[model samples]
Target chain A: MVGGGQLARMTHEAGIPLGIRFKLLSDTPQDSAAQVVNDVVVGDYRDLDTLREFARGCDVITFDHEHVPTEHLRALEADGIPVRPGPDALVHAHDKGVMRARLDAIGVPCPRHRIVSDPADAVAFAAEAGGFPVILKTVRGGYDGKGVWVVRSEDEAAEPFRAGVPVLAEEKVDFVRELAANVVRSPSGQAVSYPVVESQQVNGVCDTVIAPAPNLPEELAGQAQELALRIAEELGVVGHLAVELFETADGRILVNELAMRPHNSGHWTQDGAMTSQFANHVRAVLDLPLGDPRPRVKWTVMANVLGGDYPDMYQGYLHCMARDPQLKIHMYGKDVKPGRKVGHVNTYGDDLDDVRERARHAADYLRGTITE
Target chain B: MVGGGQLARMTHEAGIPLGIRFKLLSDTPQDSAAQVVNDVVVGDYRDLDTLREFARGCDVITFDHEHVPTEHLRALEADGIPVRPGPDALVHAHDKGVMRARLDAIGVPCPRHRIVSDPADAVAFAAEAGGFPVILKTVRGGYDGKGVWVVRSEDEAAEPFRAGVPVLAEEKVDFVRELAANVVRSPSGQAVSYPVVESQQVNGVCDTVIAPAPNLPEELAGQAQELALRIAEELGVVGHLAVELFETADGRILVNELAMRPHNSGHWTQDGAMTSQFANHVRAVLDLPLGDPRPRVKWTVMANVLGGDYPDMYQGYLHCMARDPQLKIHMYGKDVKPGRKVGHVNTYGDDLDDVRERARHAADYLRGTITE
Candidate 1:
């Protein structure tokens, strides 16, 4: 239990009844989960002494963030403290360049990409791979809609290199939809996969996720789940592993990225699945038996609330709640900021379109885009 | 949400999303729910000025306990604060004598009893009712096996008169099982009922609750649900209402007691039912549309953990958890105490007996009574 964000908060919430104690390493005084769990030590995750002290009495160490220093985790492992999704596997989530190389070596299908240390390399890759509208991403530490760039031309791609950050130039993928398939794996190599979800991104930030990826062929869903499970088993990752996939115009799925902890797309499991991703993550990290990963409902949709400039953004919830009381919303106890991941709402029902629309309406209402 | 006990704490857990905030009123710094919900004001619920301060900016005022003063609630009502299950209805729960009289007047099937102001009346009632064994209860306040006594002989029946506490006496009927039916009602008079559950009580404290009350005839379950709904409507309770019933040897259902808040018997709804009792309580208190009260599984069982003097109580959970990983346990984050309503474990499955056994084992392990 480190980092007191919504993910840590939700994980702590799920762990309480299991009689599993988690000592959260909170970054702020008002971390959402800390309000209920008192064993929080306020500190920075980057501080080695703080990390060491937090891990002292714990039997194992895990994380809420992928930004943990790999060398520090390796050091903790050397001191006999078990770190799940060990340092060897975490680097894939921390560094984009390392991930691309590893996935490419493993023959995982991905868009054409090239590591560009200099502006000239990006220019050359663009000319050979594709022209303009290339995707540029930081080699290390990027999340939500940050640390990624959409370069319309070669000149735009060259500007980031001047700032001394490693970047990758990816071919503009002609994808029909963004999909995410998540799998949880135990240290013993057992794994379970959830249904693939269609992820709708607004301004590079995920806004909505529909499980079973509406209209996706059953074969494709099977293929996507298999791909995610293969990656989890191959990486020997202990914890939830999310594989973001791109459904190309040709209906082929390509790897987009990976997350080792519980991902946003799987939040629907809180109300829709037999076992939630957060609960499974805890089980995986603790080396316990995995739970059934089947969806409990026919369809589930999750919509995220991108924080906007509204003081009483939640006040609008009264109307949404009054209109459709079945909608489930999870708000992180974090201050609102433009384009930040504030909270999410999930709805599960027999009608996918209706669930999706209702979820989106609540998100749009929360973001202050609706009059009623 | 003034009190930081298990009910308030569980409600806070459900209120995380949709951002419903709770201002916990605690008498001690370590009140369990207070530890997680940061917005707590330390005060007694008896103080009107303190309650006014607590209710200043709240949209709706609700409760976890029915012990708040009726006069203070009436004052708040006159001042225009929206208190769900207003003083009039809540008073019925706080005073057992009033509840009994009201139910008797309504023609609801209940045990023939008399409100005894002292032990002499109880002795007299026992003589009239033709019983050596009689049950005596406090009229104004009692809960969880407290404020009630069994007078097996004439001398014992007359002993409580010296204490000057008002008592209620009832014939000790031979009953097969205790059952509880939970119903939720909104301000608009719409009400919903959950499946009746057979409660297992040890020493007057409820230890386990088996949902659908195994082998209950279809007509009996329907009759219980209808009786509970009728009670809720007649009482005009604008939130959760729990009717405790005794299934006499002849199969007749007799009302035993009532609760105005989310009752412990309904905890199974959190995981087993389509709409959780907590979520429904929120909807009812907020005057929102009620959700569908359908059970997802055929059976669900909840077992309470009585914090006994067991060394390394949590250590026992490891073994129980290892055996049944999916059993859901909700802990109250309280210090250990004998006969205390510390927490509960719930398990739901199609196989009723298996779920019951699993729940029973987890609770027994916590109570230091589980055999290998």
Candidate 2:
């Protein structure tokens, strides 16, 4: 797996029981996955030589992030290396403009969007879309709300163009809430979709994810799964594919963004689902039959533990374990830093309210936000 | 952890979510836990220098097995190292004679037993206990059916005497079945016990374990748990302690043996319990609050996957995964050899029969005992 972040850290863990030998191409020895994964190659993913060296003895190459240069991946594929969610599908995740154009061509429900040449082009597209508040995003290298701007007028759009990267102008989605449809696909075209989850964001970083998107009509949930699975097939994605969606107030769902690998939105599956997304991703990449994606409990709430006032969360574990003995905590093995996702807590039970409160309390307590 | 075997491998996996750094003192880099744990010292654990170096920065010293020398542990404790299940408690697990004597002193129910000096002494004890058949076990270094003998006569009893280790002779248990009572304890005296489980032994090696021991009278089950918890506290065990027991036809429970670390009997907790035995072991050794020990489902069956006809079990993963998507497979990084434990599968659900069959089938399929 390329990019040894928390996603790779978790995928490496899921691979252990399957007896899969993980060869991680990490940026440094201190990267989250590198700290645990035995066979790790610390190198830059952009360098073709480094990618080739890392793929030498690997059966199949996969990624934790979509930031790997497309040309480097193509070179590996040219050399007969199997890259799951190959360069073609991964490019869409790397560039928002490409993803928007592909989704529009495929008739997938997406917000009105266009590739903007400059700040003026963004303003014109916003005017055509009947909006003053537009979302401007760099076509490449944006994540976790970075390289994204909510522009209410032409004057506010100038900042994004100054970075000099191509920008995509999108009509601000009038959504009631955000949802994620996570699915995994194998090279044989077999696919499995997890339940749609309600994702609550704090300052553009995901703070909590409630599985099954409470109160979502059954038919709509089925439609969301169908859409996500169709997208995986259409894009020829061979691993996990997360479709971030906007649940509009008009009772319709529109595509917001796409992640070709395991995304933060699917983290709840680690403890909630019969088969975690990380495990299925490993299976899909290996072209093995996937495991079940059914929820293990009636409800599961996952809350991200961002590094906050407490630099040592271990000090809070005693209280958390005593308060909620069933809560599953997953730490990323990273140094604590304010506003960074260092871990997550998952609580599952029949009572959604109770589960949600337990999860919130644990995450908050670990962050030192709640003294009690 | 003192030993780098499957128990340590699993404990390391459990500690990952808690951000616990495991420093393994493995005999080789290829040891099961050594392959995954980052801070590893590949050295002989029997050497005082090696043990001292390994214990330098560790917060508490613990073991995956009970074979660590009592003298070495005492020295470590003398130097102020926190040796959980310290020498005094660990010696009982290391020696069957010691365990029997201690249990007898505490009035714990055990079989008619005595430390015999020779074959004649064993024969005399057996004759006095009302039978020709007698069970003889080495006082130290026995595991997985080894160092144990069931002798029916004086001629058969002579073989164990040649080993030169002190032998404990006991009246062969005339039990309907074997059972295990598992419990974990913290240094603070807090303890939690899992339900008693029926353990099936094939050729004296554990083949399967059914949690809650199907149809066990509630009162008997409660007694078994209470016995195990009392044993943990009485021994001052600061980590997981598994009490192997014999459930006689007369509805009496007798102590068989003890393990001061994670045992095969509790493997089902990986997927069946609210908190796994390995996780609780880490917490207990760290003196942190313990987690719940309740079963997550009505029934759980765990079947050990012994290395059989197949050298590569990964070949059967696709079939087993597709056949039972909910089956949780845990494979130790070990080369396949007949009669060796390579992994185990867990199945849990409302129906005991279904869970049992699923677990059995998965284990058999992985071992290549069954083609389909």
How does each model score on lDDT?
Answer: 0.83, 0.91
What is the i-RMS of every prediction? 3.3, 1.3
Candidate that scores best on DockQ: 2
Candidate 2 off by > 4 Å: none
Candidate closest to the true structure, highest lDDT = 2
TM-score for the second chain in candidate 1?
0.96
Docking class of 1: acceptable
lDDT of 2 at A357: 97
TM-score of 2: 0.99
Candidate 1 per-residue lDDT over residues A47-147, each given as its tens digit? 88888888898878888889989998988898889998898999999988888898888888999998887767777877878687778888887888678
lDDT tens digits, residues B256-278, model 2?
A: 99999999999999888989999
Top-TM-score structure, candidate number: 2
lDDT of 2 by residue, A1-372 (tens): 999899998898787777667789999999888888778899999888999999998899999888899998899999999999999999999989889888988989999888888878877998899977899999998899999999987788899988888988999999999999999999999999999999999999999999989999888888899999999999898999999999999899999999999989999998889899999999999998998999988999999999998778988998998888888999998999999999999999999999999999999999999999
